[model samples]
Target chain A: MTNTMTTRRKSNLTRGQLPKYTPWVVVAAAVVLAAAIMTLVGFSAFGWGVLAAILFTVGLTGISAAVEGARQAKDKLATCLVFGSFLIALLPLISVIWTVLVNGIPGLTFDFLFYSMNGVTGQFDDAAAAGEAPVVGGVYHAIVGTLLMTLWATLISVPVGLLAAVYLVEYSEGGRLAKAITFFVDVMTGIPSIVAGLFAVAFFAVVFGPGTKTGIVAAVALSVLMIPVVVRSTEEMLRIVPNELREASYALGVRKWRTITKVVIPTAISGIASGVTLAIARVVGETAPILVTAGFATSINFNVFSGWMASLPTFIYTQIITPTSPSNPDPSAQRAWAAALLLIILVMLLNLAARLIARFFAPKTGR
Target chain B: MSKQTSRAGDRIFSTTALMAGVLILVVLFSVAVFLLIQALPAFFADPSEITGGEGFWSYIWPIIVGTVIAAAIALILATPVALGVALFISHYAPRRLSQGLGYVIDLLAAIPSVIYGVWGITFLAVQLEPMYEWLAEYAGWIPIFAGPASATGKTMLTAGIVLAVMILPIITSISREIFLQTPKLHEEAALALGATRWEMIRMTVIPFGRPGVISAVMLGLGRALGETMAVALVLSTGPLILSLIQTGNSTIAAEIALNYPEAYGLRLAELIAAGLLLFIITLAVNMVARWVITRNKDFSGANA
Candidate 1:
């Protein structure tokens, strides 16, 4: 008993009064109790279930407080809460990727990738009766449509937004016109995707009479969304360009316009490129605007000036909402999921490419 | 003479750039004006014939109320978690862990809004129904969570949750940058003073980063206010209502999207009016965000 007392004293001296463990013990016992109670009473009552979960967590913390010290246990409780919130944030994202991968994998066969949706039935009975391979559909048309529309949107938005940024940062000198442009661009930045679609529809309707829908119209609508992001990001990049560079170019007898075009733009090109790419990525996922302006078509239309074209977003929407083969929806859903997966892949690639472009083109500082 | 001609050419180039900038502005103003002008006739027309009604208040009041309630709920629920994540990334985590976590958080931002809607419908709806029922039964005193459940699983609460998820990444990322830039000297001073870590964060770090946090919230609010896909996907079509459990009430943008295709006569015009209202709210929110961001000098990580 004397030796044990001495040893305890030594431990207390070394470890600052041997942290209290009673709270932690209590917490543990409470948690076990809560869990047992919860199992006894099923989770059908969400209120009671959530309450039990909370009690369980709290009980664990109390147990830690008893085993460890109150302070250390509090810290542990905080760590758990932070980690829990992080997991809560992550749950949806992980579930999405997992679901898409699992559902999309079945439709990712070589034949599925190569074939078109020309003669596919979404019927399970048909598939069973045939004693053959499952029917297939292709995203080739959607892939092409997405590419064409994105290209057109890029063409329309880049020059306009770039020039506008130039005017705002370089020439306008915070003039009233520049401020007005700034205010409006800020407004446009917040414009709903659907409203942009409506604007494009109305604009095209005015130009091509009442009922006008095509890929070009969709491109215009997307530009309405894209331009604001491009303008904002480019303006920010250009504003960050060192004034010394523009002055150096001017000192070398370069005109103001020449200085802006050659030196200022080049200096900020890397950021501008990434910004423009992000803008594209931003709008490429847009469904409502495309649905409003482009309308849907099952068949591929190469020409933007034609009757109808199907972008990937619209295709996904139609496939999910109104399956042509309603008797069985698995195939249609498979196609939609594949297209959705493809869209996510495309955006991810664009983002990666943007990063690469930024890194490669960013101006290097020399010693 | 050649020099003078060249001067004219320089003038033309700058002039063209200026024209392009102004043209963009005009296009924006025109969009706002066009929507309001188209929708005005419906307001002046007979009330009995109008979809929502002719009284200016009747036409817009329901949607406005619904939009505000959902946006507010989303903003409230998301802001704290976003700030916590931002703090974790900026202050708490180790360097490599923070970097990896940052990328994961940004990945959340990259997922399309429509996918969230799809997930909400297929997965979350079935899972959350019991919780919803409980809220209705227990928290019915709070009118927001009190309403009849819909057959379609599209509830205002669901829409609000999706909007929260949509804005979470934006808020977290922006606030992370802000929190990361908090003045080093202040934090070091608090540490040297033998203050506890939480106390230090509360007293020194937050005060310094407050404006940036506010700006981040404002930016998130703007996105939430204008969010179309998640709202359009989640909302059922009906007059806007206050009940979170009820599924049919729509926001301004969602209403326009649903009604625009088949709308005719004055109905189309009223939809435009609804669009106008959304435009105005979004413009105000963006302006406030921009103003806050511009005024907050320490927010840019210049010192860092």
Candidate 2:
């Protein structure tokens, strides 16, 4: 009987069956003990010490019990870590949105939306003394400049990036030239945004005389930053087009270029559009590049080829860095905050529009 | 058939298409070369005109080191957080909850870097000061945490942290997609063999997702390394300090942004050369990431 009993105990250990509640018990004990220690150390603000103690005890008990009875301890730890990270990530995001919304709202009213910094003197004095009331200056010029510059950048990047993708996907068949292009595009994708800004500034400085700061140069700099993104994204989308589709078009006597234009692109148009939109959004709010290349301006200028032009990003940067009204800095900060909010809203709108376009234009599949 | 005319047409069409593509590539290439030459005009100029009295090696080396160190720290801090978030979205959370969380994360990605900069300055500075102070006070033994603290928050640590936040969403989204693509058969086998959920994730899921995660991290690293506006806003450009927590160091991009406007002649050229160095760094990062993705060792079955 003694020999049989010893063998049975050995078998049980080998089978990996243990008490389910073992881990949970330990966990609970540790938590309760930690809470006790915290309480001893005088950390009872908002009953946090007590709460931590309780949670610790409960979690430990649950984990031990789970191991003893259910063998589910593995998932419990992962769940804890995941939730912890989620909350940690949420902290800055929530803080940023809340802070911007709260601080920026006072200056986001109608008049503040329409006016410019033109002729505005001191922050508090200007707002109060302006023929209108408080929060008088708007981001109208900045808004226009941002739109015009971004539009020009889009024009320059899309054709080049798209055509390059086309050559890689439809034409090259993985030839030497295609490989070279691929390598270079990858390299180009990593080009520093500030370097792109520096390039634009230097190029124009040489061509149009030194200290030549114009909105067009800024647009070109933005294009340099944008093209790589467009190429990579577009290339991926094009690559996903079914080879069977291309073959089917070839079988139908459609010329290669014509087939690509009519079939492959149409099928990928939704993705291409979404990708382009994302690339635009990526570079739209670049402040440093703009500051370096385009410089900042208070009044709006429509022409991209000449003079200083205001953009929402530079506008926000200048307002915060050098408050218009030093005496009453609060109003200037308020305007800066408002501009930030507007920029965020603009990005969100672009995202939403892209999603809608994607859904609407996505190729229909029959039921 | 008019063979001569047809040949001429073919030649013209091919040449034109080739020229267009070649021109695009050339323009891109010139951007890099032109900046280098522009930045190094001191090489072309009289030695007397070089500003800052420093030799070529002295000036460029510190900035390169600063950029690399900050980017590495940012990647290290961000990787685990990104993986955790990715796992949460792909496997741990309920479907609807995960969807909502994912949307919020993407929105974070969409918010521009400048906004991050402004927020970093006004809010993060005040909020995170205590932590910075605590480090400086206690960990002063460590060179990085040891420093004369600035009243306004601008440091390598702060820049790294801001970069961490900036790249978190991107890394999480990509990693999540890769994790979700782990072969169901492999996971089910692990589960059926008495592996717990977390065990299944660790052994089967993580192994499958490794390459994808690596590429995502590389991409994030690339962005963090080359990031401009965010760094410019958060950092106080100065000579290199041994400690990361000490305020006053400059990354290559921040250096270019800060000094590009005032620099002239050879000084301007030197800045451009600095830009060329930055370009090379980014290019290496991008190429490595691309290679990682193409290896097909990770996340290959996910798309299927």
Candidate 3:
């Protein structure tokens, strides 16, 4: 020990002794080594991960124990655990997307996108079940129904939601009514999508008939779900606008109403648009509400005010659970996966568009 | 558009706003009242009037238990990973990557629930069966893990896990936002005192964000309570209640979705009654969450 200490650098002893690339080199070796050994035992990525994790932890701890000592080794363990938590959290997201794509891709096609299930029956679907023919029918009608109902729901929700938000932001002084409105809106935000459907059904059952089903009823149900989201997001956007701008408009001698319309709204319109888009995305995939209120129809119904309508969510649901053919559910399962894929794509686009709109419309702070 | 002419327009617009506010309240009251009226038959029905001689208590006990257990299990499974993701995105990710990671979370949130249902039934359920059997085989001493050992994957445990995956992005996004809002001074002070990166976060960030995180968890819990299709699809219809790892028990939302189409007379009323219960439970949770937020002027973000 005395002879080695004479040759050892004092600077290295006081500072750090391990190489900077030590962690990476050890981690790589651990992973590759664990993978090979696990393959010999049984091919499981989970087993490989567990083995590699143990190797990484013990190996790093041991190496640091020799060089940097105990405190540094403990720090490394904590850091690894933090990183491992992140990876664990990310696992489901990756798995869900990968599984959806792998299973969903085979179900999507030109025929699937364009054609409807107008005349398709169980016997007609049997060919697809045999893996000998392309899947029968498509989600075209459901897509149309989703579009029209969402459009109407948007139209209904936007006006009411916007007006209330305007009141909350521009008019109300936190009076009793306003306070009640705000509290109830928070409560309303938690109402399950199914409960809204029940309300719509009950409303129709009492007012119109016992068994009325229409696209409009579905619209009403969706509107119930959309209003709170719109109000919350729009309210947040409105509050963040600079008060000096509103004051500047007032200083210019603009009427109170004109100031709100010309200056305040134009300033916040982009966020409001994005908020509305997000609210739409939030509800478009709701299955239970539409299943209860609209009832599934294979044929396209253009009008929202009358008759049963099928949306993508319900279409996927009925196809999977009840199936077009009781004897062969493969075709139905395929269609379900396809419709799910379509819905996910639509939602993804809406989210992307919302972000773009929000970015574009945000007040330019360049000045 | 002159001031004088627009006075009437302004008045009308303000009145419309008031009307809209009134409409929201009206809608809430009506949902409660109408559901109550529909559910009255189920509450009042005699044994002679009942289907299968099932009273409201017997009909609803399993569902109530199912709802509580599924949501509780989902919350348990999701909270740790959610907190980890929140911490990572808020404190640890590279500055250039953090914003992109947040966008990824939003993308996860935007994916539809029905798609999750289909995937759970189609893939996850099948993949999870072996693990369930193994748990029962080795860890049967644990009450929740102990099962009748059917080895079927469409059990309450699967429902809980699927619900956890479905709710993950939400709790993470909210908690991440809360952590991001931690004042820099606190974090800097901790780090200046010789704390490691993780230690600084534990000392400053989580304590400051606790209320917000709690509310976020409550919000996730509310979502899990009402989640219908995924639970319906993944949880096999059954009557057992205690052994969630086994193939039995269904939540209230799934119960209504599964039974509503075939229900008649008192049966339909009972389903509506169940729906009402779900609405009340979620509403209570949301109210508490909102109260927590509003209790803190600094955290509420409401200008008012």
Candidate 4:
């Protein structure tokens, strides 16, 4: 028996196992083979990379199946596919950011941020394109319009959204009315931004008379989109507030509303605030709704209740669609890219702020 | 006196909260009502007077088909890739890297649609023109690839691709959350049976995640259907055609956005009517998605 066992051990059960560095070796081989193939055909970097990845995957899977077995090969194939999908999904994101940065930075000058397109004309863009002058128009009025409209939208949405959330969590108790509201709110979240614009237009056209476009109308349109987001986020936060806190308030003879106001809201305030900021970020870049509701203006308009207004997104759209100089669209395209950069900056800052607020002000739970 | 004041305060507070909740329902109701009222004129108007010299239905039909084709392409391209991405984050990725990767994906969501529009029109279209020409030359026998291919590459296929990118994050995040919530016991049992990692996942995680994945894809479909600015900016406008590689075919949202600025009277009502159609389509899609979620509420971690 001892002699037989010794002979078996000498033969080794690890005969079919792959070396630890097999994948690395396979990758190197695949790269070299892919480059040779690419040279034979017409070579492109993207094509070379694709060939290398395919060769690496096939080579490793085939070798594994031949030696280790089919199951291991399947596992390896799955891993490659999942990782490859992630890399492919990331390509568009990287390209978009790089493109925006490369094209946007040069157009982002002091005059572009501080001046409006009010007095600028085709002649200026024409001259700028001819290399005889600097680009003259700016996004100042658009910036003001965006801020004012977003501010008013927040004012309109927050109170309504907050109260609706309060009712849903504290008062509703899954009643019929509450269920209806909940369902409709979910439905509301799916409303197209442009449809919301149309709703605002249809509503105002009847009451305020047709063809009345203003910053206030744009604000109303934005609020329709913003309110549902705020309500959903606030409701989630409120529901997570520990029931013990509310019970403790009740045990101390506190009123229901008072307990909600004083205890529950305080505990969830950080989440609600961050959620509101996110909602703002979502609406701040809306172009279609604002375009249909407020129309566009070249000059700054301070009063939201009167006059057509221009937001950052509409400014970008109009610039691209109807260039200040049709013959030379480069200047107009430059302004659009610059405004896009500014809008992206504003959105990223808001997102960062929301993250910071959520992290720093989260309710303490003893570790 | 304190009792009286407390009672009054409760009354006021509760009433205000109730009113706010009711207002949401009212707003939704009014949106449908107002749209219908405005759209009545277009329906009643003479067919000859409409933009196409036909009725509203004829004018709207092609764009409706265009919208569906674009959204279908988006869904088909996005669903598999999104599922793969979700699996990577939930199962294959290192724990430390997964959270950061998830955040990076969410950043894709936060970029506004207009930026996507600009990127699609200026960058993607220009880059893909060559590929379209190549496909037209080599794959021309295939009906969809049969193109006197677009010179500028502003085609339905390009818009669909942009839409695919736009909705990828939504589907990925939702599927990731559901994939993470697969029961630990089931996974361990599969592994204990000497299953490979992929087999174990197929037996446990995928089965558990199937409904959740379906609902997530549906929600992504709803978003893609309703998405406006990207399609508006990316696709070149013309009458609808069968080939996706051509520069023609307009979506309902894009039609409204491109024309509403200069349109007036019946033209305005026609656009509003089209908006109503879009609203109904999205509403139905979202409702079905929600119904699926609620039906599977017991098994899903979606609500949590």
What are the per-residue Cα lDDT tens digits for candidate 1 across A40-68?
87644544434544675676566666755
Clashing pairs in 3: none
Interface RMSD of candidate number 4 = 1.0
| Native-referenced DockQ of model 3 | 0.67
Ranking by lDDT, best first?
A: 4, 3, 2, 1
User: Interface RMSD, all models, one decimal each?
Assistant: 2.3, 2.6, 1.7, 1.0
Candidate 1 stretches greater than 4 Å from native: A1-79, A110-136, B1-9, B52-59, B134-152, B239-242, B298-304
Per-model TM-score (chain A alone) = 0.83, 0.81, 0.89, 0.93
lDDT, candidate 3, B125-224, per-residue tens: 8888888888888998888788666555888888899899877887999899888888888899998997767678778888888898999999999999
> Candidates' TM-scores?
0.87, 0.86, 0.93, 0.97
Model 2: how far residue A155 lies from native, Å: 0.9
- lDDT digits (tens) for residues A252-296 of candidate 3: 877767787788878899999999999999999999999889988
| Between candidates 3 and 4, the lDDT winner | 4
lDDT per residue (tens digit) for residues B1-304 in model 4: 9978888888899999999999999998899999999999999899998889999899999999999999999999999899999999999999999999998888888888998999999999999999999999999899888879999999999999999999999899989998999988889999999898999999999999998899899889889998999999999989988878888899999999999999999999999999999999999998898788767976565445
TM-score-wise, the better of 1 and 2 is: 1
Q: Which is the winner by lDDT between candidate 2 and candidate 3? A: 3
> Which candidate wins on lDDT?
4
User: Candidate 1: deviation at residue A280, Å?
Assistant: 1.0
**lDDT of candidate 3?**
0.85
Q: Once model 3 is optimally superposed onto the true structure by TM-score, how far is the C-alpha of residue B273 displaced, in angstroms?
A: 0.5
Instruction: Please tell me how candidate 4 rates in CAPRI terms.
Output: high
Worst 10 residues of 3 chain B by lDDT: B295-304
Stretches > 4 Å off in candidate 4: A1-15, A365-367, B301-304
Off by over 4 Å in 2: A1-58, A61-75, A123-133, A240-254, A326-328, B1-24, B43-51, B96-100, B297-304
